[model samples]
Target: MFNERIHRLLKEISEAFADRRDPFNNEWLSKNDVSIDELHQLTGAVSSILDGFLAAPKETQVLLLSVGMAASSFRG
Candidate 1:
């Protein structure tokens, strides 16, 4: 069970680029004198993610919006 949990955590961290360090932490990026061009493979990542979401089917898009609304409701 512990190994399984560690595997899942590692997978999540990898997906979020936790191994890269600078992308998620502003202070680290600034401290290291990182410019926009040197963002370690994150230059077009947002555009790609947004494009993929936009390219998803309309039904899938509606489901995504609904999920967002449900999450927002919980934040209130």
Candidate 2:
């Protein structure tokens, strides 16, 4: 049973990185000093935040966009 569990876990991990050309691949992580787990967590957080933004009322979205634009302009 333990060996079967290990095999399944390995398979899942292998499938997770099946796309080598993706920026989230091992090479990119190594170059950026990031771990795969950390990348996964950040990706999840960003996805959740974006989902909230998308589901928000249109006026709220517009206000957020305006604020974001203002912030970007101040960076220059």
Candidate 3:
């Protein structure tokens, strides 16, 4: 997920999971110093960005999603 297209969007999630926290569980994040409110805000921003991307031409969206994506996301 360090594709630079989305700026390593899943890196933080990977980190939480590697640290033995449930990234999908808000309770885990809340109890582990991650603010749910901030997560919500960041999600909102991502949603907006995706919406804008969708509004672009089909070629643009295709290029953005396909180019420079998925260089590496796993290290085990």
Candidate 4:
């Protein structure tokens, strides 16, 4: 279940990049330092949250993942 979520998230992130209106102009991936792996985790956590897993103690875990994602997205 966890691995499935992770894979789904990665796909979404990759799709987000591919669907960008101006892929070349945005440079989101390069400027944000968003790695494929990090994107996978972020999307996974976000998916879990949307699926109602972001409750009580899980909220903290979700927040941490979000922070990690943000940091990694700008790791440079």
Q: Pick the candidate with the highest TM-score.
A: 2
Worst 10 residues of 1 by lDDT: 5-14
Q: Which stretches of candidate 3 lie over 4 Å from their true place?
A: 1-24, 71-76
Q: After best superposition, candidate 2 residue 12: deviation in angstroms?
A: 29
Model 3: clashing residue pairs? none
TM-score of each model, in listed order = 0.40, 0.57, 0.50, 0.34
Q: What 10-residue stretch in candidate 4 is worst by lDDT?
A: 17-26
Give the alpha-carbon lDDT of every model. 0.54, 0.59, 0.57, 0.57
Shift of residue 10 alpha carbon in model 4, Å: 14
Task: Give the Å shift of residue 46 in candidate 1.
Answer: 3.0
Cα RMSD of all models vs. native, in order, equals 9.3, 12.8, 6.7, 9.4
Question: For model 1, how does the per-residue alpha-carbon lDDT over 1-76 read when each residue is reduced to its tens digit?
Answer: 2245334433333344534443447774565455565453344544565697799999998998787667556644
Query: What's the residue-level lDDT of 65 in candidate 1?
Result: 77
lDDT of 3 by residue, 1-76 (tens): 2234224434555466557765657664555454556566546655776798889999998887664244223443
Among these predictions, the greatest lDDT belongs to: 2
Error of 2 at 33 (Å): 0.8
